[model samples]
Target: MNLKSFPDEHLQSLTSLEYMWISYCPSMDNSFPCGLWPPNLSNLSIGSLKKPISEWGQQNFPTTLVTLILYGENSGAIPFAKADDTRNTATTSSFLLPPSLTYLYISDFMDMESLSMGLQHLTCLEELVIISCPNLKDLPVTLLPSLSRFWVNYCPKLRKKCSRKGKYWPIISQIPDLDILKAGRT
Candidate 1:
């Protein structure tokens, strides 16, 4: 079913839910109820929502959440970084992501200026896919160690710069099992 707006109170009741999909909720701009999400929650998909994920992280983000899918028209611009002077680029909150997370998909992030510093906390991430974001200049260096699959498509600004040398592309190529997916360079 399509969930446009879920009451904040309902978040507490889904303690055993492993997978959650909330999309197209333009007005959802608050933390998900902390008590409802089970620690073992695995798959999570949030799309077209306005709530900053870092706020949700502070309220007890399920450590079991693995495989996160971020989509929607502006959802990718949630700014999952620490709140500090570094905010000049772009930042969210200081929410910590579970170490068990492996796969992350980001789409429609065309307005993000940069990634959040809090991203370094996720040490177990394996796959990262960024698509349709025309403004991403570079990928976070901290995201390289555990990354196995790397995909970037339809990001014109990022691709143009990456096509050259001496920047982040060289570092990206060194990823152990990287699979770069560009617009047509696949």
Candidate 2:
């Protein structure tokens, strides 16, 4: 796709658009303005853009949205567009997430080292899936009580850290359904 930018509030007119996927947008240099998103949009998959979502600053996504999937690149994802284990509280989070989400997926962020930085605000989350983040070193110390299903795959560090006897096991062990697959196998 050759998209570079869209006028502010351009997409707000489409009230019937329930889902939006903005992937493979390497040429996109800017983000959608606060009021530009479709009013009823529910599912959003955003990634592969010039700027990682972590550094997009505070965002105001649709309240009707429930599922979110972010595909990462080899680059980082935080301040200055680099990821780290900041452990900032929900009140000082670097990026804001849609609080109404029920399912969230993060994948392929080779330089990312943590997930807790952006996960604290989701009180309605029910499922979380992480995949292919080979360098990720930590999972949330405490998942929201609403979450019941969790999965991770191809994340070498996570597999080792979340294993039965691994250090982070206790954090994820309480989820009702959990699965961690070996790297390069699935």
Candidate 3:
């Protein structure tokens, strides 16, 4: 924890601080606060923190957030598209998450290719996990048929576009707990 200057009210006294898991902490670079979070933060796992999350410009998460985890540290090629300084640049950047989400996890983004719809504000997303993100290709095919649980591991182009005749498998092929993990299987 080589913390380098994080002084935005510094967690604001725990008000029953719901699960917060700040990960790897690459020298604890001075981002991670747009305001004091953790006023009942329902479960957040902000990532490796070398000042990515697209420069951490605006994040205010505390609508009792429902389980969000991200562990990408190689810096953003599109780590949920941040840097929205009142729409001043970066191609009208959007995707600011926390629409009272219901579990979202993305891991080890080694230069993400596409999370393209930027999850469209997560519309009560029921559960999504993509681990180890090996050059992830694309998802957010209209949020994967309103996912009731979907996982993709080690993403070799999302295990070849979610296989079974590919091209995203007819939009997650009626997902009711679909899990696609090949290409180094977990």
Scored by lDDT, the top model is 3
Identify the runs in model 3 with alpha carbons over 4 angstroms from their true place: 1-3, 7-39, 43-45, 51-65, 75-101, 110-125, 129-132, 135-146, 149-154, 165-172, 176-186
Which residue pairs in candidate 3 have backbone atoms (N, alpha carbon, C) closer than 3 angstroms, thus clashing? none
Candidate 3 lDDT score at position 31: 64
Error of 2 at 25 (Å): 2.8
Q: Write the per-residue lDDT of candidate 1 for residues 1-186, one digit (tens) a residue.
A: 334456756664667789887766677664563424555679987766665443343333577888888774754455454423233212224334566778888877667646535466677888888777777766668776567887778777666655636366666776766554556321
The residue-by-residue lDDT of candidate 3 on 55-169, one tens digit each, is: 6654557778898888877766543543233453434333466668888888887777788555766778889988887888887787678888898888787788898989989
Model 2 TM-score, 2 decimals: 0.77
Clashing pairs in 1: 81-92, 81-116
Per-residue lDDT tens digits for candidate 2, residues 57-165, read 5455678889988787633653221123454443332444667889988877778777766576677889998888877777656563456988889888878888899
Q: TM-score for all predictions?
A: 0.73, 0.77, 0.36
Ranking by lDDT: 3, 2, 1
Q: For model 3, what is the C-alpha lDDT against the true structure?
A: 0.73
